[model samples]
Target: MEIEIFTLCDHAQDFNGKLVIVGTFDSISSSVYPFTHAACSLAGRLRFSEKESGVHEFKIKLIDEEGIELYPAIEGNIDVSKSVANYSTINFAINLGNLEFKKPGKYAIELYIDNEWQKGLPINVIKQ
Candidate 1:
């Protein structure tokens, strides 16, 4: 089971710039996806910094070709502080093998930040 983790940096920081955001994940299984990459626009990417103040919201959903899969189970909001000026770490406990998939294939899971709509990265699950 893999729970893909993403980051929400400041909207004024450079791509290579370092920043921090309070990250949290609620998972269906104890297994979790690894922290992947950050999703943002070219402008958003270059402007994101850890030294910003505000409460950013993030959401996750599991879906498939038929449509939405897992319902909203976990929801939380983290406050991003520019004072930290460094990357903070968080983790989600998930059990991937327990998920009831409509079919054995790739599943669509999404992650959201700051009440903005975002797509979930692809995750492969093999039924044993």
Candidate 2:
């Protein structure tokens, strides 16, 4: 399996196997110690080879710089069916709301597939 695209964005959707992403960003700026981002999305596309067909466990975590989870881990299973082509792709969009940042610092959005770490997306909360 391969990750074709992964990002944090203002909005995202999977429209008939197509990924529509908007306002991709890596940082947030606020003047207060604790800030709440009203809404956002974590979007990605995963490609699976014919040999990888079957059910795969997936998990997403949002952790602070100190390795503390900001929210409960998102877990699910993805069923990949064999296609006529060399690979089959799956698009996903996880809508997040009321993301609270406790301080100005770095955070990580980590992706795990089949109990293996796949990617880490960094985000910074900046104090203005």
Candidate 3:
């Protein structure tokens, strides 16, 4: 299995087999310590081999510069099966609602598949 697309966006969805993504971002500028992000979305496509079909665990983490989790990690499952013919392309839309940041520094949106780290979206919170 492999990740073809992983992004942090304002909005994303799988609309009629289309992965619609908007406002892709990698940084947040805030003037306060306890900054609140109204909403953020994780959009991506997971590609699997033809024979790979099972229920796998998918996780997301918001971590600080010190590699400490700043919030409760998001845990979920991804069902992979041969829905099509050649391969499987699973489109996912994960929304992080009302997330708060206590400090301005480096942060990341980490992706894990079956308890293994697969990808990371690096984000910087800048105080201005």
Each prediction's TM-score versus the true structure: 0.47, 0.98, 0.93
- Candidate 1: TM-score? 0.47
Runs of candidate 2 with Cα error greater than 4 angstroms are none
- Candidates sorted by lDDT, descending order? 2, 3, 1
**What is the overall TM-score of model 3 with all chains considered together?**
0.93
Candidate 3 displacement at residue 88 in angstroms: 0.3
lDDT of 2 at 51: 95
lDDT of 3: 0.89
Candidate 1 residue 127 Cα shift, in angstroms, is 6.9
lDDT of 3 at 44: 92
- lDDT per residue as tens, model 2, 1-128: 88999999999999998899999999999999789999999999999999999999999999999889999999999999989998999999999999999899999999999999999999999999
Q: Is candidate 2 or candidate 3 better by TM-score?
A: 2
The best candidate by TM-score is 2
Q: Alpha-carbon error at 55 in model 2, in Å?
A: 0.3
Clashes of each: 22, 0, 0
Q: For model 2, where is the 10-residue window of minimal lDDT?
A: 64-73
